[model samples]
Target: MPIAITGPNGLLGREVAKVFKKEYDVIELPHDILDITDLNQVREVLSNHMPTVLVNCAAYTAVDKAEEEPKKANLVNGLGVRNLALACRDLSIDLVHISTDYVFNGNTDTPWRIFDVRDPINAYGYSKYLGERYLETVNPKYFLVRTSWLFGIGGPNFVSTILRTATKQTELRVVNDQFGCPTYALDLACFLFKLVKTGAYGVYHVTNQGITNWYDFAKEILRQAGINIPVVAVSSDEYVRPAKRPKNSALDPFPLKETVGSLPPFWQDALSRFLSETQTKECLD
Candidate 1:
């Protein structure tokens, strides 16, 4: 059976398509081709493709912007997901929806579990939480995978941002207070492919095995690139944004491991591999 992938042009979706293409007949549907917000459009695509799996990688990811545009975020992240879930439920197809660690309030000192009571503080997080709830109630065959600090070749992520800034400045100041796992999109894509094949239909928190703050992540990026730039550690208050971020969003993939057998490697190892694969030369020019 074919697998329909929404947001096929996105960072994670692109990687997922690449891997899934090797095994299954992968259907790439972009927003321009099929806007998920429209219920009719979603049903049309589902009926046309008749895919066995629907992987939803599309979302309104602008965290700060969501604060001002909650409605827009809900329409895309919340309602869009609901549409897909309902369609899949009717068709009896498995729904693999990508989620985020922001679902947690970030106050917990320990890693969060799959069953953790989500109390998101930001608009983006709340929108995702709503999507999760909709999928849980609406679809029985669903894999709600929550990830964090994602960086890959396709998108403008934190790793790329740090590399860009480091090229211009000799020293950089990053937030040391906010903690989370840095997940490589390619790694996550591979894991998701394995997960769907296993028929594990439930919530899972998947990320690289360890945790680190943005400062540490930046330092590792520079080190991996063989750069000598000095990255300074600063508190989250030093660099304020319109939206509030969780102080700690690290999640435990123990349930995922127990169910899926294993997970991706540690963050540092994954970062090094990503840097090597992309060969992003830190250049100011």
Candidate 2:
């Protein structure tokens, strides 16, 4: 059976299409072709395709800007997910929705469990939380995989930003107060595919193992590129954005490991592969 991947041109969706195509028939329906926010469009397009699985990668991910344009974010993130959930329910299709750690309130120190009390502090977080609630309510057979700090070849990411900044400036300041596990889009794509096969329908934390703050993550990215740059560790207060970020973005993958029988390698290993695959000598050197 063919699989329909929404937002197929996105950072994670591109990887998902590439990986899943090797195993299953894949149909790429980006926003131009299938608007998840439009319920009529969603139903018309998905019914025409009739894929067995629908992996929703569509999202409005402008975090800081989300504060100013919350309605746009909620419409895309919350209403869009709801539309898909309804369509999947009608079509008898399995849904794998890409979620974020932002759904958490940035309060917990330990990795958030599946049933943690969600308290979203910022607009973006609140919007994602709404999406999660809508999806779970509308569909019982769905896999909500939450990942964070993703980087890959398909789009601009934190890793690319850091490397690009290092070329023009010797000293880079990054926030050390915020912590998370950086995920390679490909690794996460593979894990999602694995989940699709297992039919393990529930919420699961999916990120590359281990954690680091922004400053250390920048350091590691520079080290992998063989670039020497002075990284300044600044507090979150020192560099404020329009949106409030999670001080604790790290996720526990114990549920994923127990269900799938294995987990992706540490984020460092993923970063090394990303650099080798995407970075040219001009970018690294």
What is the per-residue lDDT of model 2 for residues 1-285, given as tens digits with 9 covering 90 to 100? 799999999899999999999999999998889988899999999999999999999998988889999999999999999999999999999999988999887787898887888888889888898899999999998999989999988787999999889999979999999988999999999999999999989999999999889999999999989999899999999999999998998888868988888999999999999888785744775
For model 2, the local distance difference test gives 0.92
Expressed as tens digits, the lDDT of each residue in 1-285 for candidate 1 is 799999998889999999999999999999998899999999988998899998999999999999999999999999999999999999888999999999999988999988988999999999999999999999989999999999998887999899889889989999999999999999999999989999978888889989999988999999988889888888878999978999999998968878878889999999888887777433421
List candidate 2 segments past 4 Å from native.
Answer: 280-285
Give candidate 1's TM-score: 0.97
Q: What is the Å distance of residue 73 in model 2 from its true position?
A: 0.3
Q: What is residue 42's positional error in candidate 1, in angstroms?
A: 0.3
Query: What lDDT score belongs to each candidate, Candidate 1 first?
Result: 0.92, 0.92
